[model samples]
Target: MKASELAALIGAELNGEDVEISSFSSIENISEGSLVAILGNKIPEDIYSSSAAAFLAKKGADVPAGKTYLFADDAELALVAAVNALYPKKHRDGVNPAAYVADSAIICENVFVDAFAYIGSRAKIGEGTEIHAGAVIGEDVEIGSGCIVYPNATIYDGCRLKDRVIVHSSAVIGGDGFGYYQKHGRNVKIPHIGSVILENDVEIGSGSCVDRGKFDNTVVGEGTKIDNQVQVAHNVKLGKHNILTGQAAIAGSSTTGDYVMIGARAGVSDHVNICSKVMLAAMAGVMSDIDKPGIYAGIPVTSRKGWMREIAYVRDLPNIVKRIKDLEKDKDA
Candidate 1:
């Protein structure tokens, strides 16, 4: 695509001689024939030396001498639009001959079931959904339209995933929750009879697990994006648009309000309710309910101010001890 064509497609203004852009790249890794994103108001000094065919940048950004520029309100977003327009995804439909789909399973139109994929009894695959190779959709599972179950991903029995959901490779939805009871000095497993419900536009990252509920369904609210290796325990209700970063774990029965952001490796105790717009620092541990919305940090997370004060006190511990000893000696003398 030419720079002028891309600008027209992405609603960008062309500001230089139109150049043929065969591929897309970033400013850090500029290629000879690729269009690169040059963000921010001021152009970078190093960008002058880049060999990119065209620059995708903000409206007021200065274009490099003799180079084409596609100006947009938001360079990043426009770049995304340009990339999608330039490289469209290929749609693959129809069940593969080698796929194992039960006779009772309902496969919707425009859906694709790849080879080695398993669709159990009474499963209903929605239109425009793709069940990739090696994926397993258990009995009674209902996957909505435009969803993609990547290679080896599993949606256990009775689970329902809403429209536009993306389950990455190796993700296991509706797995058994970690619930046990002590019986005769041994651990007895509690059966998870309930399933998981992934709301619309929710994404389950690779290697993540969402445990099924014990009684009621474990629900992930709409637009929540969970990162890789995260864990959502049984009966936990995650609110809409929540961001659970990599390795974060929420214990069973916990509920979160909308827009809560749990940092990487953060831990939320069971039964705690986290209010909306609360942001936890990486590795922060929540022991109880967070009523107010604000930034929190540390193990057993406190307010950002409290965490900073604690850090300061710990840093002056040796001096504090020396001052205490000096006062004691003066009194004794």
Candidate 2:
């Protein structure tokens, strides 16, 4: 595609002569006729010297002399737009013969069910949805329009996933929650009778599990993105646009407000309420409710400022101990 056309599609301002951009490449591997997105404030000297045809750069970044640049307020968003324009995904619209769809299931127009996929009784699949090979949609489940259920994903009974939701391979939605009661010196299983609701535009990563609630719904709000291997326990309510990174776990009944970010390996205890716009640093452990929106870190998480001070104090512990011993020896003399 022409550089001018790509810039127009991505809403970027083009500077310098328009050139043909065949594909995208990384900084180290960029060749002539390819486009590369420059991220952050610093641009490497080698990138300026590279043979790339044009750069997708942020609005205020300094461009090298004579280099073609396509500038946008958000360089990453522009790059994504460019890539989608260059390589649009092709969708196949027919149901495969090997699929096992129940007679009572309702499949809307333009839906694609791949080979070996199973749609249970009374399930409703909306228009433009794609169920990949080996996906199992349980009884009475409702998946909205334009959704994609990747291979081997299992949506247990009664879960409802809204428009444009993406369930990656091996993700298990609406699974029974880990709940038990002590009865006669034995652990008795507590039934998970509720469902899971994934709101519009949520993307659940591969290997992640969202367990069903005890009575009410386990709701994952609109535009939330969950990373791989994350566990969202029963009755957890995640608000819109929240990001749960890899290995993050939220215990049962925990609720997070909109725009909250829980970093990799972070955990929130049961029944904890995390407020809007809160940011939990990687490996943070939340034991109680967070009423204020702020960046928090460390085990038994605290404010970012407090965590930093604690870290500094711990780093100087050895020197402080040595000084204390010297003072004790002087007192003995």
Candidate 3:
């Protein structure tokens, strides 16, 4: 599309001549006729020589020569919007010929059911929703409009996904959590007798597993984005707009406040409460509640500065031990 049209679609301002952008690509791999994203002045040297026709750049972004720029406050988001506008996803409407949708299920207008998809008894699918190939929506499940259930995703019975939710490929929602009891030397598996509730605009990435609650709902609040391979255990309540990175694990009964940022591989202990605006660093092992909002890191997760200081102290342990030994010898003399 033309640069002016693209800017209009993405709500960005067009700065240069209106050039037709055919496709979208990252800055580094962009070739001729592609639209790339320019986030800042620190463009890689090799990417500066790319043959991209236009760039979706943040306001005040330093644009390389020979590219028409669409200026946005958020370049990455603008680029994503631009890509959606230019390439627009083709959502096939109505039931697919190969899908097995129950006659009792309520499917609204403009709903798309792809080949091999299964909608169980009494399932309710709202308008403009797309259920991709091999997706399984269990009995009594309710999914709102503008939602996308990607290929091979599984939404178990009684689960409720609010509007605009995106469940990526292979994600298993409402799956049984790891709840077992040691009874007379044999482990007894506890039945997961609860459901999952994904509020509006929540996007769960591929391969993520959100276990069904033991009794209450495993709730993910509005606008939260969970990265790929993340594990959200039973009864874990994630507040609005939380950003959970890939491989993050929230143990059962843990609740996090709005705007919380949990980095990749960060683990929150069971029953812990993380306050709003808290930032847990990558690989942080949180064992206790974070009552205040701040940056935390390390195993047993402490303040970043304190953790760094402890690391520095531990690094000097050998020297400190030798000094103590010498002091003892001098004292003996």
Candidate 4:
């Protein structure tokens, strides 16, 4: 397609003459006839010298002179649009011959079950949903329309997923929660009978898990985006639009309000209640309820300001100890 045509299709403004774009690429490697996406704030120094058909970038981003550009207010959205237009998602509606779908399973219209995929007994595969190869839909599971269960993902028995939920490769939903009790001397395993509910528009990242509840459902609210390797423990309730970054974890029964963001590797302790609009920095350890909304940091998290103060004091600790020793010697003399 022409650069101007793609801009028109994606609701972006075209800044230069129309150029034929045959493919798409990141700013790292630009090839002729490829639509290069500039996601960073500053244009790469090599972009001007690179061979590229056109550019897709932020509306006000500086572009190399004489380059054809598609400028959007949001560059990420524009990239999604460009990718969708270039390589549209193909829906293969029929179940493959090698796929094993149980007799009691209800495979809806426009659904695709790839070879080696297993749709368990009594499972309802909704319309436009794709079960990729080696994916397993457990018995009695209810998957909603437009969902994508990627390769090797396992949806355990009795779990429910609402519309447009994307379970990426190797994600295991409805896994047994980490629940045990002390009995006599050895630890006794407790049975987790409850399921996990992934609400509409939620995306479970690759290798991530939402464990089953002890007695009630573990609910991830609508539009929450979980990053890779994240763990949402048993009975945890995450509010709408919460962003759980990579390696972040929520202990059992913990809850967070809407728009909460947990940075990479942050840990929320068990049963903690986090209020709306709170942001926890990377590697933060939240051990108690966060009643007020603000930026937080450090282990056993404090307010961002308090954490900064602690860092400053710790950096000066050696000097302070030497001064104290000198004062003691002077007094002895």
Q: In lDDT terms, how accurate is model 1? A: 0.93
| Per-residue lDDT of candidate 1, residues 257-328 (tens digit) | 999999999999999999999999999999999999999999889999999999999999999999999999
Model 2, global lDDT: 0.96
lDDT string, candidate 3, 1-333, tens digits: 788888999999987788888988876577788888867667776765668777777888655566578888877788778879988977779787999999999999999999999999999999999999999999999999999999999999999999999999999999998899999999999988989999999999999999999988899999999999999999999999999999999999999999999999999999999999999999999998999889999998999999999999999999999999999999999
Q: CA RMSD for every model?
A: 1.8, 1.4, 2.3, 1.9
Backbone clashes in candidate 4 total 0
Per-residue lDDT tens digits of candidate 2, residues 1-333?
999999999999999889898889887688778899888656678887788889899998877779899999888889999989878899988899999999999999999999999999999999999999999999999999999999999999999999999999999999999999999999999999999999999999999999999989999999999999999999999999999999999999999999999999999999999999999999999999999999999999999999999999999999999999999999999
Write out the backbone clash pairs for model 2: none
Give the C-alpha miss distance for residue 34 in model 4, angstroms: 2.2
TM-score of each: 0.94, 0.96, 0.91, 0.93
The CA lDDT of each predicted structure is 0.93, 0.96, 0.92, 0.94
Q: Where is model 1 more than 4 Å wrong at Cα?
A: 40-43, 62-66
Off by over 4 Å in 2: none
TM-score of 2: 0.96
Total backbone collisions, model 3: 0
Which segments of candidate 4 are over 4 A away from where they belong?
Answer: 44-46, 60-65
Q: Residue 111 error for model 2, in Å?
A: 1.1
Quote model 4's TM-score.
0.93
Clashing pairs in 4: none
